[model samples]
Every structure is written in structure tokens, then in C-alpha cells.
Target chain A: MIVAQRKPFEEIMNMLKGYKKVLNVGCGTCVAVCLAGGEKEVTVLNTELDMARKLKDNPIKIDGITIERQCDREYLAELDSKVDDYEAVVSMACGVGVQFLAERFPQIPVYPMVDTSGLAANQAVGWYEERCRSCNQCVLGMTGGICPVTMCAKGIYNGPCGGTNNGSCEIDTEQPCAWFMIYERLERQGRLDNILELHAPVEWLDQTPRTLVQPGYKKVDPEDLV
Target chain B: MKSGSNLEKVLKAGHFAFTGELGPPRGTDAEEVRKKAAFLKGNVDAVNITDNQTAMVRMSSWAASLLIMQEGLEPNYQMVCRDRNRLAMQADILGASALGIRNMLCLSGDHQQFGDHPSAKGVFDIDSMQLIYMVKKMRDESKFLGGADIHEPPKMFIGAAANPFAEPFEWRVHRLAKKINAGVDFIQTQCIYNMDKFRKWVKQANDMGLTEKVYILAGVTPMKSIGMARYMKAKVPGMDVPDEIIKRLQGAGKGKVAAEGINIACEQIEEFKEMQGLAGVHLMAIEWEHKVPEIAEQAKVLPRPVIE
Candidate 1:
């Protein structure tokens, strides 16, 4: 899931200083499960902002709402009628959601309340660890299901560098060496030959902005309609 | 004559070779490199020029190698994968070759976190194994990594590092085999303080017949003090400094630590001379280059084999 953390309170407060009225929007997906930008978090942020602003001479009003997945257009359409009532929109969703909301409401200023970190697995109730880089090319099939792109400090292929010390990365003794784990897993499975094969340099498919279209769905060209 | 380099000739002639290391200055002081090279001249077969070792910025290995070459010493030009992509690596290889450098050591450099620039992004476009394969392609196949024909491909004596002391102890020898299969002509191991572990690792390689495919050079570094040994044991990655060596250094007492360190290094060199399947010793007198001559002389590897 796309893991994100709320931006520092001071930065968020500074972005909302000039506004007299604002709408705090939250997402019900990844951020919600991570306890970052869920419905309860929006209510808490709105109350704190209200109290903090009231303490100052310049007070502001905020309305909080949590929608089901802000990435989809259908969920976003529900905010169309009520969005114009606000002077600015504060999005507690991931970067993608903020951009989508801003695209829908072009007149109102949209500010991000959270920083999108990475695609991660929820290790525990409140802990998350990055598991994938979304590099568009996956080599997990050969790497014993451990993602070197996300695990190794250098993201090296072929094998462990000379920096593998006692099963930990050279960057930090606390971090496990990705290639060490790969070698051990492959050795256990009797597929050690997989690691022996040379892996070519990554193609960097994510170097440019990427857009995906489903196999059955073709992007319609406006020129064809014309 | 794959590279026709002095080191290659010495190893090919079945002579036990001796190589020394020269770390380029942190600044662009060519004289510092020459000064260090002076001690190694006629005392060692080749001098390894490190490239931003430990991720700290320093004079480039290519430039330092050329400087030492001007001092009439053969340079084992070292190249690390942490700072260059394929384009820069290929360009540097061609330039180094044009400058008359024959030996090149490929490595995956230390992580940038340990360097002066901790925030700098490391460009590991190719690992050490891939770098070896690429250099081999440029030399033997006369082709670039992209398969483009070169006008005059660099004929380098390809070298790679093997850390037999690192983790997954059983797999270290297998990793060496992988490097050999990648077309590495020579191997320089991590510094050996645990002789028993190193003996076992080398015996495994010898049993697998890997010693015949590639020349293995045992890496050795003299501990300047007891603190240095402890730092290497606790801090440095992949370093296997045994506690007994530290106890020995401490036993040397106050003012005699440096001499004791050199004495220990000389003893290791003596053992390396008799070890089967071991081709040579790469003495890395880090920051203490002046002592290399005495160490070589005491270890009885002096008057290095002159191959014509």
C-alpha cells in the first residue's frame, strides 16, 4: 500500500494561515489503515487547527470529511457541490489524491497535509516498511521474493558487494544485506544458480512520468472524434 | 600476454608477486602520490591506486595511476561502481588505457554514507561483477557493453576484490567462483587477520579448482595501534581482525606498537609465500607507505621477480 505520514503541524498551519475557511479532506484507504489521514485524524486536525487559530487574533473555520478513495473520480464527484464553499482545501490523502482533488477543483487552492513516502507493507499496527519501488520491472522471481531494488542500499545486482558484513549492510550493521538474504534463500531452495546469472543494468522505466492503461481499455484519441 | 602488464607477467611466470597500495591524496596533490610511489618502486610488482576508498572524496585513481606511472612504477588502476554509470565507466576505461594503464581493479565502492558526502546519491549502475564482465568484453570481445565495436578496445588485466571474511562464510568461495566466471583475471581478498578462516576459505577455493582459473592475492594491512585494530573490528565492514592479533599488538607495549604491527604483517607475508594456490600478497600500508620497503625486505619478497 502507499504509505504516507502527516506533514509537520507547523508547516500545515503555516500553509493555512491566510485562509478564513477551509475544507479538510481525508482518504479511507492506505492512509486510513496507517492511522495517518483517516476520518478520526481529520477530526483531530480540524479541532487542533480551530483551537490554535482561535488563540491567535486570526481565527478560521474548518469542515472535516472523509471520502472513500480520493483517487477515483466517482468518489471525488461527491465533493463538487460543497467544494466551492471553502476558500481553500486541505487534503490529508497521499500526493496522488491531492493532485486529483486540485485537478477537480481548479479555482480553490489545495494544500497537502501529508507526505507520500513509499509503497510499503504494514509490518505492525503502527509500523510500515518499504517493500517495493514500483520500478516497473520486477526481478523478485529470481531474487527469492526479496526486493533488492528496495532493500539493498546500492540496489546492486549480480550479488552482494564487498560491503556485506556479518549478514548486515555496510551502510548500517542493523540493516540486513539484501544479497545475503537472497543467497541464503536460494541456497536453501537449491536454486543458487539463479543468483550466479548476471543481471543487466536496470532499464529505469520510471525515469519519465508513466501512465498505465488496462489491457482491454484503449485511450481514446480526441482527434478520432473530431 | 592478456594485458602485457608487469603484474600479469609476474603472475604468469609462476613468480610469487607483491603489490602495494597508494591512496591518492584528499586534494589534488600529485606530489603526494609520487612521494608514496617512491617507497614502493622496485619493492613491489604493482601499485594499486584506490578510488574514493571509504566513500571519501580524493584524487581519482586514473589520475593517480598515471602520476605513479610517471615515477616508473606499474599501477593497478582501481575503479569503483558507486560513482559511475556505464557511460562514465567506459569513458574512463578508454581514457586510462590511452594513458598507458594496463591493470584495472573493479570494485563496488563503500557506501556513500561512510564518506564526506553522506547525502550524495550512489550510482551503482553496474556492480563489481558486471564491471568485470564489461571490462572483459571491452578487452577480449572488442565490444562495448552495448555491443558496439571499439576502434581500439582497452586490453586491461582485469581484477576484482573477494571478501572471504564477510558473512555467509560458506558462500564466500562460491562468490569468488562467480567473479572468476565473470572473467576476472585476478583477485585481491579483504584483509586477513583470522588466518584459520582465511585458510579454510582458500582451501575450499583450491579444492574446487578455482585457483587455476584466477590468481588470488592475499590482502594485508599493518595495524598502526591497538585502537586501529579495535576500530576495524567494531566499525569497518567486512573486516575480520582477530582478537589474538589485537592482544599481540597490545603486548608490544607503549612505543613499540608500530614496529610490532609491521612485524605481524611480515609474519603474514611469510605464511602467504608458502600457501598453495596463493599467487601473491597485496600489502596495503594505509597512510604508512614508507614502511612498505622494510616490510617487503623483512618478508623476503624483495628484489621482485624481473620478467623480460
Candidate 2:
């Protein structure tokens, strides 16, 4: 799942400046699961903003609501009737949700309350870790399920840089060296030969900002759709 | 000489090859490069221009290297995989070669966490070993890493760094062998404050006959003071300075500490000359470039052999 963290309270409060009525919209999917943009977080942000405004002597009315998923137009349709009640929206979702809300509600300004970190998972409660780089090419099968692209500090496919010491990364001693982990795992699986063959450099050109076209589905122009 | 570089010529001719490091100034100052190169000239076979050593922003090593060449000194251009991708790396390699740089040292740079910009991303598109292979391919096979023919590939004498004191000590020699297999013609190690451990590593290299395959130059950095010694022991990662050395430095007393540090480095150099498979010494005086010639003379590496 995508991992994100809430913007600092002060930054969020600053974004709420000049707005008298604001809607705090939360997403129930990845951001919610990561505890970044969940309904619980929305309530906390709403309360903090109210308190901040009261302390500043410029109080504004803020309402909080959570949709099942912010990325889908069908789920966002539920907010159509009442979204006009607010002058602006504080989107507590990933980058995708904030853009979607902006596109759906053209009249209201949408602000992202959370910073999208990376594609990661909750390792433990209150702890999240990045797992996939979405490099568009997966090498897990060759590396014994270890994603060197994201785990390795340098993202070098064929290493354990010289700095790898005792299976730990040189950059951070707490984190395990991805290549060392791959070596040990590959050794255990008796596929150590996989690392011997040098892999070519990553195709960065192909990994640039790209759009995926759903196969066999008619692509409709957004203006023509409505 | 394979690359016709001065360092390569010195090593090939069986002379004790001495190299010094030139850390470019943080700003655009060609005079700093020339000033350091002038100090090292005639005292060392080649001067290594570091590429943003310790991750601090510095003048590019490429420009410094050319400046050193202008000073009539061969510059061993150092490269790190931390900043550039393979495309940029290969292009720089070709450019360096075209501009009279013949010795190339590949390094896995110090992480940016130690630098001014800790948030900057490190682009280690390929490891040092792979970098060695890529350069060798370009030089020997006359082809790019993608197998496209190069009209004139760079002819470089490949070099890489080895930190024998680093953890998994037993595997250090094996790692050296890996670099050798990747086409490293020479190896310069991390600073050696722990001579006993370095001896053990050299023994392993000798046993594996790695000495016969490539030239190994031991690294030496003279400690300026007891405080500096302690800082290196405690703060520097992969540095294994024995308590005895630290005590000796502390014993030097304020008036004679710098002299003691040079004496210690000279002793290491004397010992390295006798060690098996050891080619020579790479003196990295850090900010004390002025002392390089004296250190070399005291170690009796002066009057460098004039190769045919």
C-alpha cells in the first residue's frame, strides 16, 4: 500500500488561512490503512485547526468527512451534494486523491494535508517502511524476493557496496543491507549463481512519468465523458 | 605502460609507486588544485583528485585533474557511483581519457548523510566492481556497456579502494579478488592505522596470489594530533585504530604530536615496502599537502625512478 504522513499541524493550519469554511476529506484506502489520512486523522486535524484558529482570534468553521476511497470517481460522487458547502477542501489523501478532488470539484480549492512518501507498508503499528520503487520492472524472482531497487541504499542491482558490513547498510546501521540479504537468501535457496551474472543498468528512460492504458477499454476524453 | 599514465609506468617498471591525494576546494578555485599539485610534483608518481570526498560539495575532480595535468603531473581521477548514472559515468570516463587522464579510481562514495545535503539521493546505478568491468569493457573491447562499438574507447588503468579493517574481515581479501576479476589493475586501500590487521589482510591477498595479479598500494594518513587520532578512532566508520596507537599519539604531548604522527606514517611506509604483494603507498595527508614531499623523503621513497 502507499505510505504517507500528515503534514505538520502548523503547516496545515497555515494552509487553512483565508478560508472561513473548509471541508476536511479523508480517504479510506491506502492512506487510511497507513494511519495517515484516515477518518481518525481527519478528526484530529479538524480539532487542531479549530484550536489554532481560536488561539489566533480568527476562528473558522471546519467540517470533517471520510469517503470509502478518494481515487475513484464513483466514491467521490457521494460528496457532490454537500461539497459546495465549503469554500475549500483539505484533502487527507495521497497525491492521487488531492488531484482527483480538485478535478471533481473545480470551483473549490483542494489542499493536500498529507505528504505522499512512497509505496510502502505498515511493518508494525505506527511504523511504516517503503517496499516497492514501482520501477516498472521486478527482479524479486532473481533476488530471492528482496527488492534491491528500494532496499539497497544505492539501488545498485549487483551489490552489497564495499561499505556493507555484517549484513547492514553503510548508510544506516539499523537497516539490513539489501544485497547481503539477497546473498544470504539466495545462498539458502541454492541459487547464488543468480548474482554472478551482472545485470544491465536500470532503464531509467522507460521509467519516466508514464500513464497506463487499460487494455480492451475504450479511452474516452475527459471532456467528452460528461 | 598499458595506459601510458605516469603511475602505471612507475608501477610497471617495478618502482615503488607513490601517489598523493588532492581534494579540490569547495569553490571554483583552480589555483588550489595547482598549488597542491605543485607540492606533490616530483615527490609522487601521480596525484589523485578526489571526487567530493566525504560528500561535501567541491569543485569537480574532472576539472581539477586537467589542471593537474597542466602542472605536468599525472592525475589519477577518482569517481564515485553516488552521483552519476551509467550514462554520465561512461561519458565522463571517455572525456577524462580524451583529456589525458589515464588512471581512474572507482569508489562507492561516502553516503550523503555525512554531507551538507543529507536529503540528496545517491545514484549508485552500479557498484564499484561493475564500474571496473564497464571501464575495462570500454577500454579493452572498444565497445560501450550496451555492446555498441566505440570509435575510440578510453584507455584507462583501472583502480578501486579496499577497506581491509571493515567488518567481515575474513572476506576482505576475497573482495579484493573480486575487484581484480572485474579488471582492476591496481588497488589503493583505506587508511591503515591498524597495521596488524592490514598485515593479516595482505597475507590473505598473498595466499590467494592476488599480489601477482594486481598492484596493491597501502593507504597512509598522518594524524595531526591526539584529538584527531581519537576522532578518527571513534567517529570514522571501518577505521580500526588500536588502543596502543591512540595511547602513543596521546603520549606525543602537544609540542611533538604532529611529528609523532608523521613518524608513525613513515614507519608504516617502511613496513609496507617489505610486505609481500604490496606495490607502494598512497599518502593522503588531507589538508597537509605541504608535508607530502617530506613524508616521502623521510620514508626514503624520494628520487622517484625515471621510467623508460
Residue B307 in model 2: shift from native, Å? 1.7
- Global lDDT of each candidate: 0.92, 0.87
lDDT of 1 by residue, B1-308 (tens): 99999999999999998999999999988888889999999999999999999899999999999999999999999999999999999999999999999999999999899999999989988889889999999999999999899999897999999998888888889889989988999999888899999999999999999999999999999999999999999998889988899999999998999999999998998999999999999999999899998898888997898988
Q: Pick the candidate with the highest DockQ.
A: 1
Q: Model 1 chain A: which ten-residue window has the lowest total lDDT?
A: A217-226
Model 2 quality (TM-score): 0.90
Model 1, C-alpha of A190: deviation from truth (Å):
2.2
Q: Candidate 1, residues A18-86: lDDT per residue as tens digits?
A: 999999999999899988899989999999999999999789999999999888788998898999999
Docking class of 1: medium
Q: What share of the true interface contacts does each candidate keep?
A: 0.79, 0.40
Worst 10-residue lDDT window, candidate 2 chain B: B166-175
Q: lDDT of model 1 at residue A68? A: 93
**Candidate 1 local lDDT, residue A170:** 89
Worst 10 residues of 2 chain A by lDDT: A198-207
Model 1 pairs whose backbones collide: none
- Runs of candidate 1 exceeding 4 Å displacement: A221-226
